[model samples]
Target chain A: MNEIKIFSPATVANVSCGFDVMGFCLDTVGDEMVIRKVDKKGIVITKVEGFDLPLETELNVAGVSAIAMYNAIEVDFGFEIEIYKNIKPGSGIGSSAASAVGSVFGMNELLGRPFNKTQLTEFAIKGEALASKCEHADNLAPALFGGFTLVKSVSPLQVLEIPTPEDLYATIIHPQIEIKTSESRAVLPKEVKLSNAIEQWANLGSLVHALHTSDYDLIKSALKDVIIEPHRSKLIPLFNEAKSSAIDAGALGCGISGSGPSIFSLSKGLDVANNVKANFENVYADLVIDYDIHISKINTKGVKIIG
Target chain B: MNEIKIFSPATVANVSCGFDVMGFCLDTVGDEMVIRKVDKKGIVITKVEGFDLPLETELNVAGVSAIAMYNAIEVDFGFEIEIYKNIKPGSGIGSSAASAVGSVFGMNELLGRPFNKTQLTEFAIKGEALASKCEHADNLAPALFGGFTLVKSVSPLQVLEIPTPEDLYATIIHPQIEIKTSESRAVLPKEVKLSNAIEQWANLGSLVHALHTSDYDLIKSALKDVIIEPHRSKLIPLFNEAKSSAIDAGALGCGISGSGPSIFSLSKGLDVANNVKANFENVYADLVIDYDIHISKINTKGVKIIG
Candidate 1:
C-alpha cells in the first residue's frame, strides 16, 4: 500500500460573529498527519511531539476524525495514523481542529481522495464535534480550503470563499495559557440583551462590507465586539492592554482569536504589522510571541497534499 | 435665491442584521425633491405628490427631513420644498427615508451643495430619528451614496462602499399594505436568546462574506432572519407566500425590504429578476408590485442636481 502524508494548517475559529460557523487557516501554524493502509482490521494511532495527546480511538482528536469518516462512509480499510502536533494544545488557535482536519485530509488522500472538499469538511466537523461537543466548521473550512473563508451554514456545512485584500496582514500572539474550549463555552450567557445582539450584527455586517471593498477605515471602525469580547477578555491576562497596544501600534483591529488566550491583530501594511507585534510583545511580558508573523496574503488555498 | 432639482433614491434600511447602522439605495424607485430658495427667513410649505401625504411639517415626511438638516447645520435659509414622492409611504421601501434623504440632498443643492455625502447622511439620519426615535443610517447612507453601502459606525457616522457584483440583480415587490415602521419595531423582542444571537451573527458574518465575494449561494443561505423576520412576518399579509413565490421564481433569496409591505428578492441574472418580479405580482393580487430589477452597481454620484 502507498504511504500518504498531508499537512493541514491550524485555523482560527469563532472569528468574532462567525462563532462556530466561520474560520480561516493560518499559513505559519497547524499540524501534520501521515496515513498508511495496512491489513489490520482496526485503526491505530500515534502522536509525535508536543503535549501528551490521547491515542485512544474514541478519545483522541485524530482517532475520532478517522473513526467518524470510517463509520460515515463504511470504509472498512484499517490504517496506521501519525499526528505531528505543532499548534500548542489549548492555546485557542484551533489546535484540535488542526488534528481533526489533518486526519480527514490525510485519510482522504490515503483512500485515493474519494471525497471532495465539502465532504471532507463534513467528516472533519464530526471530529471537531467529538472534541468540542459543538458542530463548528470555522476551523475546518479554512483548514480544508485555506486563507480567509466563511461557513454559511453548518447543518449542510456550506462554505464560501471571501476575497481577502492583498494589503491585509495578520499578526498572531499565542499567550501560554490553558483555557479549555468547554470552559469558555460554559462562561457564555444563555441569554443576551437584544440591544447588544443588534450592535454585534451591525458590526459584523460592516466588517464583511469592509473586507469586500478593502476599506481600511471601515474595517477599523467595524472590528468592535460588544458581546463575546467583553466577557471573554476578563479571562485573558492584560487583555485590554494588549488590545490597546496593538491598536495604538497601528493595527486596523485586534481581538481574541477563537475562544481565548491567543490574540490576532490585522494591519494594512508590513510596517504596521511589525509595530503591532512589538507592542503586543511589550504589553505581555511573559507572552511567547510568535515573531514569525503569518504575514502572507489571505490563504486562499486551503489544505493540499504534499508529495 | 436659486432653483435646484435633486433626486434621492429610495433606500432599504437594516439590510438584514444591520438594523440602524446599514442601508442601500434603489435605482428604480425613489423620491424627487425640487427646492427653490425664497426671501423668507423661515421654511415654507410647498407641494407634495405621490401617495396621500400630509401637509403639516410635523406630520410631513419631507418637512421633517428638511428640519433635521437645518437643525444640524444651523441653516437659516428659507425654501419652498416640493417633494415629488415616487416611493410610497409606509411601504418599507424607505418611503419616509426617501423624503428625508431627498430633503437633505435638495437643501444642500439649494445651498450650493456645501455638505458632503457623509454630512448629508448625518442630516438624513436625524430626520429618520424623528420618525423612528432611533438614529439609523442604513437608509440614509444608501440614499446619499447609492449602491451597496455600509454604515461602519453610528456615533461618528463612518460609512464604506461595498463592492457590488456586476451580475447582481434586485427584484422588489410592494404589497400595497401599510406596515408602519413603528409597529414593526414594536413587534421585535426586547431580548434574544444567546443561541439565536450567535446564529444571527454567524449568518450576518457570512452575508458580508458572500457580498464581498459575490457568492450567490452563500447569500441565499445567509438571507435568513431567525430573530426579526419571524415576528414581523405575522404583521404583513401574504408575507410567507410572497417570499416563497419570489424564491420559486428564480430569486437567490427574498426578504422583507426594510420593515415590511415590500419584499426584495436578490438574483444573479436579469432573467431570474424578471421571473421573481412576476412571481410576486402573481401572488399578491391586491398589491402594486413595482419590479425594480437593478444591476448591482455603486452610485458614485449621490443626491445631486441632474444637470
Candidate 2:
C-alpha cells in the first residue's frame, strides 16, 4: 500500500475526422512507472529505463505530471519515481502522454486515490504541456480514461470516453524516423475553406454515429481527413503510399498518427489488421525504410496498477 | 391507387453546432401535395395553393424535384401534381424542403415506390436547388429520412437518420419577420480561427455522443453554437433574451432555427417545452413583436402518405 507500479497505454490523437478533438488508447505499447511516497518535500526521479529521457524530476514528462498532481493535493510529501519508457518520444503516438498519465495515476493511487479521473487528467496535461508546449488534453485523455476519448472542451476540461465495437481493431506503423510535433503542426493551413469545413464536420458526425451504431462501412466513409492530412502528409515519408496500400488491403481508412513519422489504419477484423501490417511492410521494403508495426484492439482499461 | 396525398414535415437544419450537416424533422408543421398518374409522358402541376410560387414545372421547387424523379424511373408515364401549402416560407425553417420532399414522395408513391428514401432525397434536392440556388441537402435529407438526420457528405450523397430519445422535445418560435437565406449567410466570416474550429468540432463530437447515449446534460452542453449563433443572432429579434429565458426555464439550449427569424429550443420534458414557449412569448411581448410557436417531440415518421 505504500508504493505501486502502474501502466499507462499509448494513444492515437486526431483520429482522421477528429482533428484536434479526438483520440484512442492502445492496448500493447505504453509506459510503466513505480512511485513511492518519500519524506522529502518535492518529487525526485530515482531511475529511468528504455530511453534517454531527462532524469531531472521537473524536466521529464512523467516527473512534471507528478509534480502537477503533488501541487494540487495538500499533502506535505514528496515522491521518488522510477520510469520504464516503452513508447518513444516523438513517436507521434502518445509517448509523452503515457509517461505523464502513468506518473499522475500512480501518484494518485499512492496518495489513496485522492483525485477522480478528470482531476487526474488536469494534472496530467500539465506534464504533457511540458513536452507539447500547449495545454491540450486530446492525447492524455484516452491514455488516462481509456478507449476512444473526446476532449469536448479544454477550457472546461470536458472529456468523454466513447464506446467502440468489440470486433474493431487498430493497425499502427511507426517508422524509425523523427518528426518534431512543431514541424508537423507548422504545415497545416491557417484557414480552411468553408465548404471543406462543412464536409469535415459532416464526416466527424458520421464517424461518431458509426461508433455508436457499429457500422463498419460508415466508419470507412468517415475516416477521410480532408484538411490536416492533405497538408501534413508531405512531412511524413511514404505517407500516401502506405495509406493507399492499407486501404487496398481493406483498412477502413489511414492517416498520420498525431503528427508524423507514424501512420495508423482501422480494421474490423484480425485478418484486415494483419493485411494492413503486411502492406506497410511491403511499402517500407519498397522504399528501403525501417518501421515498427503494432496490431492492437482498442484499449478499454486505461492507466491501471500492475503491482 | 392512382391518386395519393402525401405530407412532408418542415425541418430545422444546422442544429446549433452542426451548421450545414445536421437537421431534424418537425411533426405539427409541414406541406401537403396531391399527385395523380395521367396519360402523359412528363410531370405537371395542375393546381397550386397558398403563396404565389412559380407555376412553371421547372421553376417550382416541387415541380423541379418531381421532374428529377420522373426522369430517373423511365416508366413512360407522367404525374399531375397539386400543391397545398401549410409551412410558411421565409420562416427560417425548411418550408422549401417540405414542398420538394412532398412532391417527390407523392410521385414515388404514384410510381409504386420505385425509389427508396435515399433516392427520393436525391430527387428532392434538385427541387430544393430551384429555391436555394445551391444543391444543399441539409434540409431535404431530414424531410425524407425523418427524426434527426446528418448529411455526412453532399458529394457522395451520404445521409444518415440519427436516433432520438423518446422523451426529447423541441420548442420552436417563428417571429413575424423576414431574413433571406442569402442575407443570413452573408454575415458569416469567410475564415474561422483554428481554435474556434477545434472547439466547434468538439461540441459536434459531444452532440453525437449525447444523442447516442441519451444524456440530457451532455446534450445541453453540446447544443451550444459558438460559430454560427453569434454571427446570425444579429439578424433575429431579441435572440439573446429569448435564448437566455428558454435556458432559464429549464430548456436544454436555444438558438436560431435555420438562419434567423425563427428560433428553436430543446427540452427533456413537455413541461419545460411549454415553459420555453411561454418565455418566448414574454420576449416578444417586451419587444412588441408577433410570433408563432410550436411544441412537439422529434418526428419519427418523415414524408408519409395521407390520403
Candidate 3:
C-alpha cells in the first residue's frame, strides 16, 4: 500500500542568539498527518482538525506543501492528506512548521520517497509562505530534519544539523495568549548599533562552540539576546521576571521562545528543569490567565513515520 | 638561567565574516622577543629594532605588556626584553598584537610560567590598550594561542580555540600603503540595518560550524562581510579587482584582513593559495606602488619559545 502517516515535532525558532537562522525540535509537542496516494495528479485535503485552520489546498499549509511538492516532482500522481495539528498557532513555538513539514514528509513517502529531507523542507517553506509572509526556515528545517538545525542561507537552501547534548533539557511555558508573528517581528528595530551587533555575533559564535563542546558555562555566558529580546520582551507580561526566576532556580539561560506569549528556559539536567518550571509557576501564580508548562529533552528526530 | 625567546606570528583578524570576533595566525611573518630576569622589580626595554616603535617601557607594547605581566605577579623580580619586529606596523596583520603577545609570553616563561595562556592573554590586552584606545584581542589571542581563535567575550576575557582543517591555506597581499586602524574604523557606519546584522550573525555562526566540521563549501558561502568592507574598502586601492582575481584563481574566499592596506584570501590547497597569490600579484602589477606577497599555511601553533 502506498500510504503512510508522518509526525512532525514542534520546533523553537530563533534559539536566543540567531534571530532567523537557528531552530531546534521538541519531542513533547507535535502534529500528525496521514497521507495516501490517489489516481489523480493533484493534492487533495481530506480533513483538517485540532484547529480552525483552512481546509482549502491553497490556504492550509498541509495542502499547500503537498501541492508544492507535487509541482516540484511534476509526476502524474496525487496525494490526499489528513492534518491533525497539536501545536496552537501564534504560540511562538513553530506551530505552522509542524503542519507544513508533516505534509511534504508524508507525501514524499507516499510517492516512494521522491525528495530528500532538504528538498521536502523547500516545499514546506512554500507552504509556510502561504500562511506567513516571511520566508524563514528556522522552524521548517528543524521540523523536517529533527534535532538542532541552522539555516545558514535560505536562497541555496543550506541547512546544517547541530549536535545536541544528551543531558540538556528544555523547559517551555506557553501562556494563554496570542502575539502574532508579524506584530512581534514589526517591533524590532530597523537599525542596530554596530557595537551591539559585534557583541551579538561574538555570542552567537560562542554559543555554537559551546553546543558542540557541551560546555555549560559557555552556554550561560553566550545565551544572551540583546537586540530582539529588548524590543520584543515588551509584548509578554512578566517575561523578565520569569527569566530571572528561572535563572535563580538553576536554569542555565532563559528567554522568550520565538516572539512572545511563550517563554523557554534551558537547564543542565532534569532536576534543574523541573525546579525552573516551579520557579516559572511562582512568577505566574497570581495571574488570571491560564498557562501550561512542559519540560522535555531536545528532539533528535524531526519528522517520523508513525503508521 | 631564567631567559627565554618567543616567536609570535602575524595574525589576520575579522576573517571576512566575523569582524572583531575572529582571527587566525600566519606561518610566514612574525615578531620575536628576547626576555631575561633582572635583579630589580621594574621591567625595562633593553632593545627595540625593526621599526620606529617606541622603546620606552610604558610606550611600547613589548614593554607595556611585560610590565603588565610583572605587576600581575607582584613578585620582587624584573625582566628585560629585546624586540626584533618583522611584521610591519599598521600593516593590518596584527603588528602590535605580535609584539604584545610576545612580551607576556616571554615574561611568563622567565617567571617560571606563572600564568596560564588565558591569564597571559589578559595581560596582553592591557598591553594593546597602551597603544590603541580599544582593548581588542582579535589579533592578540590568536597570536598567543596559535591557530584560529575566537574572542568570545572581552569583559571577563574569554578566548576560544577553533579547529582548523589540514588542507586550509592563507594568501596575503600587503600593498605598501598606510591606512590607519582608527581611520578605517571611523569610516564604518555607526548603525547597521537589522537585516544586515542578522545576515552577519548567521554567517558568523555558519563560519564557526564550518570550521568545526571542515566544510569548505559552507566556508565559501558564509565568508561575505557586508558591514565593514563596503565602507572601508573605499580606502584601499584596487581592492575589488584583486579580490575577484583571487577568487577566480581558486581561493575559497577573500577580503580585507583587518582594517585596511593588507588583504588576505583563504584557499583549500597550497596550490590554490599560491595561484591566488599570483592572481593578486597580477592585479597589482600595473600599479606603480611597491607591494609584497606572502603565501603560507595557517599557523596552528600561535606563539612559540624559539630560544
Off by over 4 Å in 1: A37-42, A70-78, A110-112, A286-300, A304-307, B16-18, B38-42, B51-60, B67-78, B110-112, B166-177, B180-182, B267-282, B286-307
Per-residue CA lDDT of model 2 for A25-100, tens digit only, reads 8998888889888888899998999999889988998888888888777877788899998888898899999988
Evaluated on CA atoms against the true complex, candidate 1 attains a DockQ of: 0.60
| Clashing residue pairs, backbone N/CA/C < 3 A, model 3 | A146-A302, B146-B302
Q: What is the TM-score of chain A alone in each candidate?
A: 0.90, 0.97, 0.97
Provide the interface RMSD of candidate 2 in angstroms, 1 decimal place: 1.2
Which candidate should be chosen as best, given TM-score against the real structure? 3
Tens-digit lDDT track of model 3 for B1-307: 5888888899999998899989999998998889888888798898888998887889998788777777777777788888998899888899888988898888777767879999998988988887677898999988888889999888889999999888899999999998876788789999999989998999999999999999999889989999999999899999999999989998889999988689999999999999998899999999988887888899999899888
TM-score rank, highest first?
3, 2, 1
TM-score against native, each model: 0.87, 0.95, 0.98
DockQ of each: 0.60, 0.76, 0.88
Position A227, candidate 2: lDDT = 79
lDDT of 1 by residue, A1-307 (tens): 3577776777777666555555666676667778787777667886566677878877887788788787766555587888778787777777778888877777787777788888988888878888778788878888888766767677877787766677877788877767766678777877888888888777777766666667788778777777788888888878899899988999988888889788888889888988988888788766564322344345667666665
Displacement of the residue A282 alpha carbon in candidate 1, Å: 3.6
